[model samples]
Target: MINLRQAVFYEYVDDGVVEIFDRYKWGLRRLGVNFSQDLLETIVYCPHNLENTFMAFCSWVLWLKSKGEKTNPEILSETLMQALKSDRGWIPYDYQKDFLAQHLDILESPQLSLWKAAGQQLGERLRNRIISDISEEGKINFHPNSILTDEEKEKIEAFKVYIDQLYL
Candidate 1:
């Protein structure tokens, strides 16, 4: 799992130095971005009103993809929120609060806002999704497969399949 990484590290440090500290584990490839398909699959399936929240988010993706331009985090976030609110006349304040809280903190670097960057965040968010930690959150970081009705599950599965094809 770590041959390349080890070689790189040892190239700088001698064998004796490494023996002095054997507990450390070197992992190659820092955690920076996520895969496009993972985020698409998660976004459509992660609860928060399929018609309103899900469709609005999808529209944001489609819109960004069409533009094919780079954007900083601030503009991207504002544009996405504006699009969502404009589509429904009004977006719930609770959802907005939760969305920012859940997604913004980890964006230490400037966000790309393109479909790929937006999609990349989905995996980290899903893996980090915790019921106890985000009870008050109204949107983002949600997956409730066991709690869904059969019809709801079908809708989520179908949407995930559709988006998966598009991303590929």
Candidate 2:
């Protein structure tokens, strides 16, 4: 099994974010003088907010403008699609879509209570795993792999006798 910490923190390191940035740079290069350092940095460090999304879209437009390419929504859409497709594994599209859809208008709705309740339930589940608090029923659930074979049980019995003899 993969170490949970390593899996969770994979995106924060140089090997992860740097590699994705390098690929985006390459795609921009193909379009000529394609990306700016500021733009790259903003994309790397910006929070996933509407303002930052708009900034990223503007950066793409600027890059296209520099290349004498048409600056339109289609161009921005194509660039974003390319960026997403090239880094699908690192960037989970489905989760992003769902989170954005759910939270984008959360401040405007009375359904915030429902969202809070759901979040609380998820928090409790995570807490249970961290504390390793198993119920009485859980203790009754024996792992088959941990069971001793007949031969192993006999050896254990012999070892018990050997210890008993030392006391005698």
Best-performing candidate as measured by TM-score: 2
Q: In candidate 1, which residue ranges exceed 4 Å CA deviation?
A: 1-51, 83-168
lDDT of 1 at 36: 34
Report clashes for each candidate as comma-separated counts. Answer: 0, 0
Please list all clashing residue pairs in model 1, or write none if there are none. none
TM-score of each: 0.20, 0.23
Hey, what RMSD does candidate 2 come out at? 20.4
Tens-digit per-residue lDDT, 30-106, candidate 2: 23333333344444553343232332433544445656886444455456544433422123345444543443332
The 10-residue segment with the lowest total lDDT in model 1: 23-32
lDDT per residue (tens digit) for residues 74-118 in model 1: 454444334434434333355444553454322222112222333
Highest lDDT scorer: 2
